[model samples]
Target: MIVSDPATPHRREGFESAPDPRLYNDDLAPTEPIRRTWTTYNYLALWFSMSMEVTTYMLASSLIAGGMNWKQAVLTILLGNVIVLIPMLLNAHAGAKYGIPFPVFVRASFGPMGANIPAILRAIVACGWFGIQSWIGGQAIAQMVAVLAPSTTGSPVVTWVCFLGFWALNMFVIWRGVESIRFLQSFSAPFMLIMSGLLLFFMLHKAGGFGPMLSAPSHFATHSAFWHFFFPSLTAMVGYWATLSLNIPDFTRYAKNQESQLVGQAFGLPVAMVLYSFIGIACTSASTIVFGRPIWSPVELLGEFHQPFLAFLGLVALLIATLNVNIGANVVGPSNDISNLAPSVISFRTGGLITGFLGLAMMPWKLMASFGSYVFGWLVGYSGLLGPVAGIMVADYFLVRGTQLDTYSLYRRGGMYEYSKGINPAAMISLVVGVAAALVGRVMPLVSFLYDYAWFVGFFLSGALYFVMMLGHRVRRSAVVS
Candidate 1:
């Protein structure tokens, strides 16, 4: 039954209403319209800052290293991003319309307590990413040190120091709050673009020309071989941003309106990813001609430069890019997810600090040890876990509830979302089934395609299952104030 509290003035706003202390906190509250100030430019800048990082470069360059040429790798990245953007936009809608973060927004589908299952799962992945990005940033710092003092090059002691120092910088930013991230992304996006352009120009010149740089032929001998590689690679590409595809509400909740977040992300995500990835492909291809072998690591490539001054500038750009992405993409989601565990006790700053410590424990250096491990093992692996969550969320919001959420009930203990003792059995069952289906290919060689197409399989399977399971479930309408 749809419940209405006509006597309450702020029924829909979810503010100025008494909420369960266990579920309500200032950080997790539905944002007021007045506080929704993020415009299209802000989101555009957000993606621009995020996509210019070393990992995006590695994501493309790894595909090149795997076998495909520049053209094929670029197209795969473009298609994957476009596919993921659909889920991103769909999920972002709730955040903008309801003005709630991912954790709170998820309660509508997962129920109040069960929401933590997916939130923690997502947080763990973000912690892994935080570690990976921090490791890259530390490498950049270590490279800068090498340029100054050659003896310190490859020193494990110096590397550890740089890594922890970089990690500390990320924590400092988190302490300052979310608005600081907005300011950081806005200021860094354009500068990072300029730096990327310079790097592209340098690579082209060094490799003789664009033709020589991109002249590499496909290593795949047969159509079958290429197709076999393509599916998983494409999945990895999609999986790359699959994390954001689920947690975008964390950012979009602050958007000024639907148009701003929608248009900003539409323009920013794919364009920035494809453009910057093209740079990675072109530069990595150029590396083969310039260095006589593929130099996929930009950090290592910069080290080959004769001038320390130029290398220093390149490292500095990398530092900014890594920091921008690590904080914006990695820190925000996990911090909020952790806060959801105990909203009254854990604040955003505390959650961010915990994320940093967990990032260290994840040992990112081993995760990025090889291109195969980074793309196939890590990227594809997490996608299998997160895809089902996305499917459940999108299905619950659009298919079942029709995007109408009782915003106030979200924070109340016995409200509309309190299904079956604060957990929705159907959502949980669908999630497990979806994850198992996507990952079963690992153990069963015959069904390996499921693993290769992990994200797509999990997304569709869970979404359909959830839709069917919710067929008889009654929809709850939001309260209307008289």
Candidate 2:
């Protein structure tokens, strides 16, 4: 009803402009959204939050313990980071241009009828993470309480109650919607930085020197074994990192420009990432030196500190930082994704609430078993799905579609995206075929030999399938147009 003039100065243009007007559908875009104040520092802080969590700590320790020699692990980390950078930045470009969430962009490739496949898959994975991360945050509080209230028995009831309490708290924050999420990022990021600084200082003091510990491994493994372990974790990290690449447009759409997005990536990925890695390494290494054993949990590591005041400050900061990363990387992406499934019916906040409650009801504790870290492992499987989706989406956008998305059709059911009576079988078929191939390479017990390369396998499979499908479509279109 109220359409802003297309030529108005407030209208964004160029590569970053909304080329497809469908994105302006009422009740979709945020009102009074923040301009592109998200500079290199904000992106850096984002990646900082992402890479500095319990997962990062566990992965680093696993890399070293799995016999990757610290040097090999470091190489794997660097290489994996570089590999994810390309796709992440590409997706960010979409966000900057249109200011729409990632799932909305999916309609261009998957069609309005079938975009839900990837969107739902992404949302399911996100919900699991929501519960898991909330549980972890709750444990951080439990650890802090244990130190203060040493006599209180840490029973199952207390643990679950605290976990549920924290879970609800996050749900409330998310219910407040994107503005609340962004505000949380702004408020906590600086405090996390200060805490990280203090963490590094204390870790170095405990280590006696950074240099000695960097080279402190007492045992070494064969180069082949080192490669085996290093590559898996490295590949896993890349898969994990790229999980957000397809969805980052959710956040980057708020970014000011492609320049800002890249700046954010630069700070967000390599610089922010390596800083977090260094701190994680330092913290874990210091624990080894000081307590005579390595501790994977930052919460547990903080427990060993003597000063009560320092422990309190460190625990609170770590808790906030971990929660920030989970909410940003894990929650918001899926919120946008699930909402895109039925734009008329579900708003982003409603979708988040839906997924949040579903996550809690799934009994996430079942996913955690001694048989293996199944929950995290299942996440890796879900991440494998992301690679092909990215490859297909990227190929369709950049190669076949020429980076021009039909934004309007993304909202209307019988609009231009009705490629063939409500569904694009090619997209659906390619997704299944690609995911099947990836599952074989990653999780099919028989092909365990090639498991380390699942992401690469998935990427090529999806890209090739999508390309072939597009070729067929183009040829058919030419026949009709002539």
Candidate 3:
């Protein structure tokens, strides 16, 4: 809208060639709302299941393991969800209103070519996440195998085979299509919940009672120590869902209405996180009592059970829970981003293959080596990259774009969005600075304290930088023309 070419403001469609239908068409347009079919109940179910998965469970325990009291960890997780919902809602509005996903929506501010900056960043993060989720599922299968053949359980060969097995299961379900996933999600949600309930029951039985078990102590001794851990843990908590905060449109686009997405996210995220986190914290604390040490990994905990029948059932539930989350969280966003990279050649299915292979190549095991690695390296690390992207998007959409985007121009290669030869330097440079700063904070001991607030620092700094530069870009262009 603020481009230099006078033709840009008024010229909506002067393309030398027609935009490829594969790139954009009815499927990617701001038409055909899913509003008719998606009731509030539908959204509630969607978000509920999305929240209660292996990732959330692992994250909750990681917080406690990292140093928080059980109560402190639950509160941190709850607060983080409530905070992230702000950006998630803002970003989802574009998708819900325009039916455009994240990559296209970013074209408004980043230019069509430059939009790839954030898209690729997000896809890469999702790829790493895909690996972690696959590892989780594979670990569950290994535990199950351990139940039957206790001798072979710890073999690296067995673990690698199980990992491939889990990966193939995801690929099969994906190739089978949305209807199959729907059934898997529905079936898995109930089984996952029941499994969690049973695990809680088991923990209670083993710990002697809730009163003694839930009294997990804060490893932080002093107020300074507690707050010191709190900030980073809070960042990790927010960073946990930072991916969904950006890519939520991939789901909310299917919402019946804005209200459905908003209300459902609000109602479901905090409550599910709080409740599920309680289960995690309680079970983890109970593990400390029963095992004489904390057992953060659920697979390892389940494997410790002597009864093969119960362990097998628990492993089955873990597989289903991790499987559903992997498909939804890992599969959808990266595939969409990948297809956007080369829409002509790559269909969503093809992109999914790319996502899977790249996920494996990322060697995400080192990132999840311990609860600490998972919290810091994977969760907080990716958040530092993703937070800036989310900030630019939300700021551009609401402040600069005025919540308006030309849907057609998004597909047109040389339309209004083709600022400065298909890239907005402001957006690109802002992204780099924010990401570089966050990375520096992560690795450099000098500014390492900033890593504790990495997401907040990156989000606010990038948003401010982009907004300011865009204003300056518009003002300078107007002056030169005058």
Candidate 4:
């Protein structure tokens, strides 16, 4: 009944000398293979969309809340970006070199069957965050709707309706898959920039100048309390954004070449983040003067506006912006991860839908309301694992493996990645030990002062543990063979 086309090119044959072609697409073969797929400008737009969102603004303000002056706060943000740049650049190079997602790339270091461990962990984190961000975006929508319809706003039923409506809308777009995502991003990125510009113009008009906005906060009575608050907040900002740095390969795999990947990171990440941080400062500062209260949430500030049309438009823009960030930075990486676990059963679109559905069902508002601060701190501590995993991967690939990955080993169980019965004990031990060491301070209040440096601690511990374990394993195996 079916005849294969004799002239059809073999799927793997068309792949350009890359370690893995699956990296290029979201594991879905393009109707026609994309040769000249992405440009530098596309990446610039991506980073801009990533940074110019309510979550980013909220985090930046948190840094200010930590008692750092504007200058120190900005520096702390910059340092965090720089700290993440190491793994970001390495991971992007691997993606551009291999044309695969991060989960697939890890097969080189973790081994084929071993790769699933990191993949599952990453997917879990992404799914949790997807639910959280969507719920947050839903709350913004509900609040904006209430502003428009004051009569209906007070009812709990109306709030749930708005949340479900926004949730369904995001699912519709996500289900349409990558092309729809690209198109949604096209309008979203430009619209957010325009909105930010409008907010900045309004702030300048309302607050007099930028200098007064930055210097106005002199409420801290003690220098020690100020620095104490400032450092952790700064570290938190770094840790939160550090999530993106680990997953940068998710997007860079589509890059036309290595040069394009480098250019994208160089131009895209820092510049876009800095601009967003500045706008957040200006907008929040203006809100303080105009509303006479420090309105941390952008939607809250927008809600205070008398004009219903403007308020509605702002929420719409925010919704688009939030979705853009969540899908690119949060959803895509994990979706591919889930598919990696079961390619035949779980298509990329299906995986994305699973994440999106779970996100909607979870209802992040209750979590945020009850445990926002502790949750934020925990996420930061958790992300420290990324730094070490990343370091070990880089060391393994470039230093140990000499930039050559056995691609086929990733598909075959008990091959390159599988160590003992489909698990890599060395890798597992490193992750567990590093995680425990990083969080020991947090769990034990007597030594909680060390909790803030969890990122660095986890990173070093994971790398050291991995290297030593692997070295010992190699030696034992060699002695037995001899």
In model 3, state the lDDT of residue 260. 81
Model 3 stretches with alpha carbons more than 4 Å out: 1-18, 21-31, 34-36, 472-482
Better of 3 and 4 by lDDT: 3
Full-model lDDT for every candidate? 0.91, 0.68, 0.79, 0.67
Residue pairs with clashing backbones, model 3: 35-256
Q: Number of the top candidate by TM-score? A: 1
Report backbone clashes per prediction: 0, 2, 1, 5
Q: All candidates' TM-scores? A: 0.96, 0.88, 0.92, 0.87
* lDDT by residue (tens digit), candidate 3, 1-482: 43322112223446454454545533344435433345566566666676677778888888878878877888898888888888988998877776667777888889988988788989999899889889888988988988999899689999999999999888887777545655666677666777798999999999999998877678877999888888888888888888888877777667667888788777877887888888888988899889988888888899999989998988888887788778887777888888887777776677788889998999877878888888877778888898888888888888776775666677777766788888998889889888888778777899987787888888998999999988965565446556
Give the higher-TM-score candidate: 3 or 4. 3
State each model's C-alpha RMSD to the native: 2.6, 4.6, 3.8, 5.5
Model 4, runs deviating above 4 Å? 1-36, 370-378, 472-482
In candidate 2, stretches whose alpha carbon ends up further than 4 angstroms from where it belongs are 1-37, 218-220, 362-376, 442-446, 474-482
The residue-by-residue lDDT of candidate 1 on 1-482, one tens digit each, is: 34334223146545475777778788888777788999999999999999999999999999999999888999999999999999999999988987888999899899999999999999999999999999999999999999999999999999999999999999999999999899889989999999999999999999999989988999999999999999999999999998899899999989988999999999999999999999999999998988898988898889888889999999999999999899999989999999999999999999999999999999999999999999999999999999999999999999888777777678876877898999999999999999999999978999999999999999999999998998767432322221
The local distance difference test score of model 1 is 0.91
Candidates 2 and 4 compared: the better one by TM-score is 2
- Candidate 1, residue 185: the lDDT equals 98
TM-score of 3: 0.92
Compared to the true structure, candidate 1 yields what TM-score? 0.96
| Deviation from native of the Cα of residue 100 in model 4, angstroms | 1.4
Flag the better candidate by TM-score, 1 or 2: 1
